[model samples]
Target: MQNKKNVTLLIIVAALGYFVDIYDLIVFNVVKKQSLQELGFTGDALKANEIFLFNLQMTGMLLGGLLWGIMGDKKGRVSVLFGSIFLYSLANILNAFVTDINQYAIMRFIAGIGLAGELGAGITLVAENMPKEKRGYGTMIIVTFGALGAVVAGMVGKTFGWQTTYIVGGGLGLTLLLMRAGAYESGMYQNLLHNSEIKRGNFFSLFKKWSLFLKYLACILIGLPIWFAIGVLINLSDRFALAHGLIEKIDIADSVMYAYLGLSVGDLASGLLSQYLKSRKKVIFVYLVLSVSLMFVYLFNTNVSVEYYKYMCFGIGFGTGYWALFVTIASEQFGTNIRSTVTNTVPNFVRGAVVPITLSFSSLSKTMGPINAAMWVGLCCLALAFLATLYIKDSFSKDLNYFEID
Candidate 1:
């Protein structure tokens, strides 16, 4: 009973940690234009700077993922959790006071570094500690609860103004730090820590073997469409609406709210369905197809009413609802020693894929226009994800109590 209590408490901490992570993650998308305009960026400068800041933040995550993932294995998941939250919480508070674009970018990059650690560390702890048969549900609860932070971001970003939104998000993270006090380390991680003979947290070792490299690459690939949709389709929906000749303007925050609302429902449904079906690949395959089909619908049609366009955003978000399952698969794929590294780096790499994705979109837009550029870029992402899904092994019933060798 006490063990179960500890597990429950750990899940609660992971869930709420992820909640703040998502809030800070999505809040920038919600307030990008308002905040940028307030800093005096107008016309093409606004669009260019938006991409710059967003990509810079993703770059921070790319680096931070490596930093925290290595630390999660070498030190412990609990320490990474505390350290990451503290760095990001302080950075977020500093974000409220930025008076120029450079300051804004610096704070965002710092906050990104801090934000990168939360989900991977939290998920690693939950996965290592939970029973194999029920870990999917555990991860599902964290992600579903966490995704709601985007909805709250939409509300708070709209109601509280951009500066207050940053303050509120940072405050929530600091408050959650108090609750992190009750969390315990993963038993698997703890056991691995005592065995100095076992190799752990070597990021370069993944590249030493062909099969290992491919598996790691496939894990990252299967998640590309998720970020592409959110990063391009939903985040830049306003520009798309203008290109489509739609009379009504799209509100960035509302689109994110509606889409994430679908994402929350989709995550819940996919989690239950994966358990019932007892296969991760099948659920992911289905969601990937649904997302791709909706992307075509979203791009091909110009007759959609503003309300209908928002519904389409919700549909696309629902279709890509395998976010938690994707991370869970990565967590289950490796040994306890390097599992945190794999889990952390895979998601952020996909997020960082947005750098190339948005860059490609921008370049292609100059020649073919934004709608067609998005369609082509999205198709490429979807195709890669589908093929990679076929290539990687299903980890649903795999044991994770082993170590990776050097």
Candidate 2:
């Protein structure tokens, strides 16, 4: 009974931790226009600044992903949970007070660094500690709860305004810190810590071998479409709406909220479907196809009502809901020594992929227009994701108690 209690507590705390993470991560998107306008950015300036800040934030996550992943492996998962939350929470509190774009971008970068740790550490802990048979359910709960944070962010950003939303996100992270008091470190990680014979947290080791490099690359590639969809298709909903000649401007916040709500449902459904099908690759492939199909529908059907467009956003989000399984596969693919590193970095790399994805979209937009550029980029991302999926081995039932040798 006590054992079950510990597991339950971990899951709850991890879920809330991720909840705050998502809230902070998505809040900026929700409030970008209003906040930037308040800071004197408008028209093309506002759009340019938004993209810059967003890219900077993802850059921070890319760097922080490596930092925290190594720390999680070298220091401990619990350390990451505590340290990451503190950094991000403090950054967010300061974020509420920024007077200029430079300050805003810097704070967001710091917060990105902080947000980088939550999901990887939480998933690592949950995967290591839970019964192998039920780990998928555990991770699904974390992601589903985490994804709902975007929904909450949408509502909170809409209700409280941007500054207050930042304040609330910071407060939630600090509040979640209190719960970490009861959390325990993963035994698998502990075992690795005691065995000094095994080298741990070696980021460069991933590239030392062709096979290992390919596995890591494939893991990262399979997730590019998810970020491309969110960072491009939905994040630029206003621009797309303009391009489509809509009668009404689609509310970015509502589009984000509805899409995330769909994501939550899709994560739950995909997680369950993967369990039922007993094949992570198959489920991911199916969802990737769904995602591509939805992307085409979204790009081609511009004459639809605002309400219908929002529905399409929801469908796209749902189709991209294979994220939990993607991370789970990453965790399961490696040994205990490098699992945290791989698990943490894979998703962040995917998130960071938004930088190039956005850049490519921007360049292509110059030549083909925004909607057509997005269509081309979306197709390329989907194609790469499919190819990557072909190379990834199924890890649905793989054991986690092992090590990556030097």
Candidate 3:
């Protein structure tokens, strides 16, 4: 029922969701130390707690993602996207008022729910609407805009305070709700409504399918562990940056800005990179290996000569190579009926399972040098990417039907 011109509006609304998603999450990572201290994490190694907090955020992302996936598939991606906007915005605003680490972590988990909702619904909306050849392009736009949100959060944190940053993120999330309400549902879903009976399925049937089951396993094996590290790092990076004085005294907004700028650059380049590579799996493969090696080198080479340079490289490479690339690959691997199902749920369960265990790993990293610990974790996770990449087929130039959920 919608024309190609409507596609323009789709990009704007969808990209706005992505933007808020990044804003909500990236601040935790960029200003981890300051936030932890503000909420009463004090010790010789306040930084260590960052890993646990990071786990909480990732866990939230995973859980939110799973629920959002099911809801989007059943209720319509637009409905879920709007739902995400409200949840994350309110949670962010509330996050500013929390007082203790326990409360902070709990609040973050709540916020993560909103974060999960937006990411799941927004991604599915873009993938469902875009032409097959350009799905990656649209996804890249979503990622880039979302990454830009991090930049905005970071800049705001640096200029004002983390609380102020959350206020902006909250306001942005609130403003978008009305915009999202005006958006349309999937053309595919509309067709289903007009020409077919609603064959309403329950939650259990959604996951019982063998295809979704295997994809869930893959998400656990390859996706969750790496994401565990990513979540921890994002929540804790301000401390790391300040460690070398590239950032001095964890000015929350500035640290966030540094991270956001890095991710935005990576999103743009990786989007182009994934488009040109003609093979998402292979590009992911190369970046996974390279990012690990680079993370290790960056960790030990603490020469003040290039402190900010190292932080910039780490943020950009992490965004371009490890973080955004895998999702693009996963989106195209599942068919339409189950694509949203796979994208949203698989990452969630995998993250949930991995987070607690990964917290132990983070503890070890915290005891060790943050960089050293990250390198060790990065290497292990990258190794998983290596194995998964071998099994993941290229989907860009292929027909969607060629790759079903399994």
Candidate 2 lDDT over residue span 120-227, tens digit each: 999999999998878999999999989999999999998987899999999999988988999899889888978999988999999998999999999999999999
- Greater lDDT among 1 and 3 belongs to 1
Q: After superposition, how far is residue 247 of candidate 1 from its true place, in Å?
A: 2.1
**TM-score between candidate 1 and the true structure:** 0.99
Pairs of residues at least 3 apart in sequence or in different chains that clash in candidate 3: 29-234, 29-235, 151-260, 154-253, 154-256, 154-257, 157-253, 158-253, 158-254
| Superposed Cα deviation of residue 49, candidate 1 (Å) | 1.0
- Of 2 and 3, the candidate ahead on TM-score is 2
Give one digit per residue, the lDDT tens place, for model 3 in 202-257. Answer: 33544677765555455445564345444444445554565555634434445346
lDDT on C-alpha atoms for all candidate structures = 0.92, 0.92, 0.64
Please identify which of the two predictions, 2 or 3, would achieve the higher lDDT against the true structure: 2
Per-residue CA lDDT of model 1 for 318-388, tens digit only, reads 99999999999999988998998999999999998999999999999999999999999999999999999
Give lDDT: candidate 2, residue 232. Answer: 95
